[model samples]
Target: MRLLTRFCSSFPQQTTSVGARRGGINTHNTNRHYNSLNASSSSAADQVPVLDPSSLSPSLTRGIHVFNCPDEVGIVAKLSECIASKGGNILAAEIFVPHKKQTFYQRSEFIFNPANWPRAQMDEDFLKISTRFKAVRSVVRVPDLDPIHKIVVLASKQDHCLVDLLHGWQDGKLPVDIKCVISNHERGPNTHIMRFLERHGIPYHHLGTTKDDKREEGILNLVQDTDFLVLARYMQVLSANFLKAYGKDVINIHHGLLPSFKGGNPSKQAFEAGVKLIGATAHFVTKELDEGPIIEQMVDTVSHRDNLLTYVQKSQNLEKQCLAKAIKSYCQLRVLPYEQNRTVVF
Candidate 1:
């Protein structure tokens, strides 16, 4: 994927008299960056260029692009040639191709001097290459150096998952802007957790549920300014209307293997069923409760001695890990919808 450029020009000259001319050129470079970073083709090798990063500006914009092609190795070489030729440098890349599938997939990040090269010309050049390779999909964006995605986390009483996410955001491990943290409980019995958010200058919304639709309404209002929602063990079941309103914009982490042990106290259910494995699943919220498409999952082995308490503790750990991964994927634009599931094109 290549970043395409859009340009705008303005003239400040009067057109009344023939000799009354006095206009200066005003140009605006509105370059739209493409995130799909992949290249293919037998002759693409001619496009790659070699560059020294030290020669470029310190504040360079970065972007990722992906391409789907069966034989991408040759294309990768060609793409490298193109970037090198244009004084652009590839920072990172990853490729994937299933054994039974004939198609190929690739994700690559690159740095370029937008001031000099601009996006429009780059897009045109990339389109020529894409046409030759018959690329499937492409996306491009300037990596958000400062808060990009606005996220609102909803939790019932659990603090482990929420706490981990908060820490990740504060430390810059997760690239997102956590607009607020909404809970059905008033900080529960854990005052330390409340202090943590306050210390970080992060706002907290404690709208305790009461009458009918109160919790739903509160959540809807809180998330009105947010781009995405994360249900970090937010125990209440969302109504059909809520699901329809948010749809794929909401992500939930369940303390169960999902499609198996769903609903209240999943750890207890797994223990009672004598299952050998207990796990956690992170997925998008749908009208069918835990039946939504999964984004990430983690499992842990259990023995007969493991009781409900032990299983719950283990599942909590798994939940924290899974939810964090899912959130990261969303911020990076790596997760894509694939039928009733997700395709994390990492």
Candidate 2:
């Protein structure tokens, strides 16, 4: 808990096509990038971009833009104008201006005739406004027109979250290409998972680690060319060096409500504490263990009648949904980094 091949946006990317071990065996890439626009590439005179007939959406296609920049007057007007100028209609806009903060955060969804506004031109338009606002983060995505995110999952023993993610991918509820699954533990209790990965042609790596060596090099080699990593209850703590090397976002699911029962066997910790509430937390992975910004959380009621196994079961169920929902949100371009260790998950 770490991923980019950038095209001027902050989100990580891969090919329009995904190979089996490269991401998925047969993931659906329904929308091909239709760059039919025959425009000369130039912003010298700041003219409108010419549309490519091939890339044109026969109907209005939805586009998403997430921006974080310094707050100032006329920001909204400029944003509106940027889209409106290109024959795009703003369907919804959400802006967050934190109190006593210089930061400005916005997530916008709009519909545009791709014939009038080419994909490349949209990027240029956003780039111009982003530069003017001195933005720290800027990303625009047309889910129907761009590559689906490619991700790798790291787990140790527990396959609840991992299994759920696999099912989600299969059901198409989670729009992603799972490059592979990496684990430092044996498949002793996870034989079915092994069979599933084998049958589906999804690569699964079993790299054993010890106190002397966490097998960082092997993990890095496997994770190369990925958009991001998911810690599906990957027990080991990822080192700062590994995260720095990867330089992308890492999402992890904590078994218990974070800041409460962190660092191993949280179910037992919560049980010992006699707490009535048990939950799971999905968040960005930082070098400081579970201290990263939370993206999603889910809770379930527990009482004295509940036993340790019951608590564990409930936590596992929550973890599966929490992690899956977080991944879905991230892939939809609905997540953005905000102020220190916090996120603007629209």
Candidate 3:
């Protein structure tokens, strides 16, 4: 492999916001155990058949790299050359070069032989490229090797979104290790939610919050080791202090199209407005209430025939599915927060 370390090191210094530790990589474990969590079901889910990751050739280990840097020429060429030098084959790649931001973003998937390009050397090779470009973010993920992302789900009385996430996790649709489920509302002893969590060995916490005590401290302690947090139709607004202390990504699902009917009873708001289309938006939760960066949105047509109840039902269905889709995309490393509360979903 071409050791471009010396050449890359010669480049002049620039401000770097790269999140990975120097000389190392940003690697996270993906919760892909559902493939084995339900071994029999896995076979049927893939009736059409596809490449089995377990059966991959020992010479071909899959790797995905996400790169962000200043917009400049030859970035892609250099990245491709790096992988090629390491005896890696690029299977798929996507790059985003925007006009206003003058920045570069890329997600590249490749396969290589660890026997030839050991993991440490592979990271070094990519680190060289990242330095050469003065990248803001440069990270690689080996899904097969990384552990599942650990997360906690927060919800209120609403159970639709929560239940869908549970099923998705059970079936392996979501590659996440749900550390626990937290809610402000209490559940009875024999409830299905309580029982399923009990059977799976997932912990559950019920917090009672008032203005005086939002119980963010206890919640923070519960999620201290988690990679991220999810609000599945969670009703309470998180305080700025809570978000600052958490200092990690928090995703929330909104029942209405954002920048539209924003607050509570959005369905009612849309229904009264006589809108033509209603939608659900799943986005990152910032301190600014429902105004965070959006990841995925699902919309459907509304008509005069639809009543307030119908609107709510339709919105609930959309909300459950949209949130799950966003979480899946996030676990797959396809959702990236971008400039001005936007997202670059690859």
Q: Kindly provide the TM-score of model 3 when superposed on the true structure, using C-alpha atoms.
A: 0.82
Residue-wise C-alpha lDDT for candidate 2, range 1-346, written one tens digit per residue: 1211111123222211111112322223321211211223465354443344356566888898888798666676787788888888665565555545656767777779888899999999999999998988888999889888899999998879999999888888998899999999878535889888887889988899999899989999988888888999999999999988988888888977677888988888889999887888888888887877788888899988888898889889999999998888788777766546566666
Residues 1-346, candidate 1: write the lDDT tens digits: 1111111012121111101111222113221112212323256474334344456577666655666554433566666666667777776665444334445555667897777557766677667767777876555555633348788888888788988998898899987888888888886435877888878777888887764655787678778877788888888888889866754378888887678988888877778888887788887777787887777777889898877788778888999998898788766756543223435335
Off by over 4 Å in 2: 1-58, 188-190
Per-model lDDT = 0.67, 0.76, 0.76
The regions of model 1 sitting more than 4 angstroms off are 1-61, 67-85, 95-105, 117-137, 144-147, 188-190
Model 3 ranges off by over 4 Å: 1-59
Per-candidate Cα RMSD to the true structure, in Å, reads 14.5, 12.9, 11.2
Which candidate, 1 or 3, has the higher TM-score?
A: 3
lDDT of 3 by residue, 112-197 (tens): 88888888888898999999989877887777777778999999897889999998999988989999999999998799899999
lDDT of 2: 0.76
Poorest lDDT segment (10 consecutive residues) of candidate 2: 1-10
Give the lDDT of residue 183 in candidate 1. 84
Candidate that beats the other on lDDT, 1 or 2, i.e. the better one: 2
